[model samples]
Every structure is written in C-alpha cells, then in structure tokens.
Target: MAYAADFYIQENIIGYTGDSQNKPTVYFRSGHKFGRITQAYPDSNYQGRSLVREYTDYSISNRPPKGTAEEYYNGEVRHCSRYPFIPVDDNDSLKAVLAIAIASYPYKKPIYSK
Candidate 1:
C-alpha cells in the first residue's frame, strides 16, 4: 500500500526522498534511480529537520538548505530561506495540473480553459 505524500528537494535532479526507516519511500524519476525515493531511511535530511538533518552523514554529501523546491527542474528556484513553492488554489491546481501534463506531452500548444 503506497501512500501518496509530499516531497523535498535536493541539488540532484533525481533525488527526492520521504521519511520512513523501516520501509522508506521508493522513487525512480525517469528510471534514473533503482533504490529508495525517500532517500532510504537515515538518509532523509529534510530542510524541515535541521542543519543536522540536511547535512546528515548518511545523506547527500552536498545537501542544500532545506528550502529548495522539488520542482526545480521547471525553473523553480533551487533554494530559499523559506518555503519556495507557491500555494495554488484548488481551481488553479486542478486546471494547472491538466495544462501542465498536456503541455509536457502534447503535440502543440493548447488553449487553456478559462
């Protein structure tokens, strides 16, 4: 039973993890990884944790400040002193989700719904 959850950011484009020691989340972005999604336990160093958490010895050797957004690939900023992601309203979220998906894969520009 995989529980859908939120994510964090790392300097690496393919490294986003969760929090769980026994069965940490497993993520494989574009098949770039074959291990854990949530950084494989003791490996989760959320910016939400602490400097120790972000710079934990078991995690990435170069963990940026925890304020980095997970969507950094979409021109999202890499890091900030505070939460970097913009809060989207429900209608915007639903509409944008479809638009993004279509724009990311469709053959041509799409006329977005109003």
Candidate 2:
C-alpha cells in the first residue's frame, strides 16, 4: 500500500548579474514511513538537457543515522553517488510505479505553439 509522504523541490538558479540565461539545478526529496527518496536534476535548462537523476529508497527496517542535519544531508549525497535505478522482481511493476511517479509531478509542456 502507498503511504503518506511529503515532497520537496530544491532549485538552484545560476545566472550572471546581467545575463538573461538562467540555469537551474533541481533536487527532489520525498519522505515516507518506509523511507526517504531523493532525485537530482543537474544543469536543467529550457533545451531539456538530459541529466542523470539519482534515486534512493531506504527500507523501513534500516536504522536512521545519528547526527545533525549536515550529516544526514551529507549521507544522502553520498548514497546518491551510486546509481539510482533499483531492480524489481517484475519489470512491468517497476515501469508502472515509475510512470505513476512521473505523472504525479507537474511537468510543463513545451511552448511550441507560441
């Protein structure tokens, strides 16, 4: 069963003081009873530059680290250093889950008409 959770998005916008070009780095984090999951989108721009999104799903049985926010966030950063994709018993199930997650996000369509 799906559990209740809170999702957060952290964006880092980069631009020169006088430049109009803005580059964004987006990071997503969701926490649930089972565990927490995080995704990072680097060098995201209007051109849709492909970035390696990282994900981690900590099991409920795992123990939480004992430390402050710095340590916790640092550990998460390290955990994301590994590949994000998790192997599921059924490929179809994995695809379905991923599809739902992606659909939940408020993705903007390309402004081709304008």
Candidate 3:
C-alpha cells in the first residue's frame, strides 16, 4: 500500500501539477484539492514540524495565518501542511514528499526548457 501510494503521489506531482499565472501548484488526483505554497516564513523549514491548518475558504487577498487548502482523494481529505511534504509514515526516510513540495513551491523558476 505504501509503495502504491508513493507511486501515485509521484505520478500526480509529475503529470498533474498545475500552474496559476505560471506559479506551480500540486493537485491531488486531478481535483481542486491542491496546494500552492506562496511564501515560507523567515524561520520556515521543511526539515522541522510546523503548525499546519486547513481552510475551506481561501484566497490570496483574504488570507489566513496557517493551513492549506483541503485536498480530497479516494473519498477522503488528503492531509497537507506548511511543510514541503506529507509523510507516508512515521519515518519519511527518503523525503519524497519534500521533493514534491519543492517542485510545486513557487520560490524559484526553471532556467531552461528541454
């Protein structure tokens, strides 16, 4: 189950990630249940646990302090965080989720296209 879930996540990150004004955002299972990390606080670090929240009504202008937009997949709300990735288990050994978060994060732009 873990491997399948991880593969699914990876496939989504690669094939289904969306862009808003060229800003990258990740969608879980091709739905609006997605995340677009705007800015990381000065002390923000993906390597550490941070307070994460969920929001039903979200917008850039009318923003809240924490939490990410709710993502629904397989008939459940997919858990999300301010951190880069959602851990599949207690030990996120490979940090695959972090890689997805980085890919979807809007901090840097790609230099060239292949």
Candidate 4:
C-alpha cells in the first residue's frame, strides 16, 4: 500500500520501501536524496529526515502504526463533505493520494535531502 510518503519522488516514481522496517535504500528525487525512512524515530543523525511512512495496514504485524496524524488527515479527506478532488474513475486512489501529498505539504514543499 502506498502512503502519502510514497509520492516523495516525481509524479510517476514511487520511492518504494516494502512492508517492513529496513533503511530505505538511497536514491535521488527532484534534485534531492531520500533513503532514511524513519526520521520520526528519534535518530539525531537524521537532520531534516522525513518522518517514516505512517500509513500501513494494521494487519501488517511488523509495520508501524498508522499514526493519528495520518488518520486525522485521511479522516479530513474522506469524511469532509466539501472535497472536490475525489475522483470518480480509474486510478482514483493514485490521483487522490498524490493530490494529498502535493497539496498538503507545507507550502507544497517536499521532504528533501538533509
């Protein structure tokens, strides 16, 4: 399952980290580097590290909890009655998730290399 963090790269690329806790292998995206996937875990070395992808199925025994922040955000997205970006066709999940990633970040800035 792709979380909002999966859209960190370009619109077409997904910075895929599988459904387990492994250091995300390093890669470049939009002139920045991304790899460390758990900035939220309190590693002092990860200056400017993006928080780990918090969205995951509860059934995944090894994955982190889908934190309240994401739950609330998604709740806002799904429960809100005024959402116009909710698509009605194929790739609807993709478009909706990408829309969340793109428009939700602070001033639309992405998580970049430290």
In model 3, pairs of residues that clash are: 53-67
| Count: clashes, candidate 2 | 0
Worst 10 residues of 3 by lDDT: 105-114
Clashes of each: 6, 0, 1, 0
- Per-residue lDDT of model 4, residues 22-101, tens digit only: 32211113223222223222443432224433332211111135321111222233111111111123343443333333
Q: Could you estimate the TM-score for every candidate?
A: 0.21, 0.21, 0.20, 0.21
Which stretches of model 1 miss by more than 4 angstroms?
1-16, 19-21, 31-63, 67-71, 77-114
Off by over 4 Å in 4: 1-12, 16-28, 31-96, 107-114
* Best-performing candidate as measured by lDDT: 3
Off by over 4 Å in 3: 1-5, 8-10, 13-23, 29-68, 72-114
Which pairs clash in the backbone of model 2?
none
lDDT of 3 by residue, 74-98 (tens): 4455544332323223244433543
User: Taking the tens digit of each residue's C-alpha lDDT, what string does model 1 give over 1-114?
Assistant: 111112111211232233222222222222222212222223234311111112111222222566433422223333222223232233443333322222222221112211
**True lDDT of residue 25, candidate 2:** 18
Instruction: Give the Cα RMSD of candidate 2.
Output: 15.9
lDDT (0 to 1) per candidate: 0.25, 0.25, 0.32, 0.27
For candidate 4, the 10 contiguous residues with the lowest summed lDDT are 78-87
As for candidate 4, its clashing pairs are none
Query: Candidate 4: what lDDT?
Result: 0.27
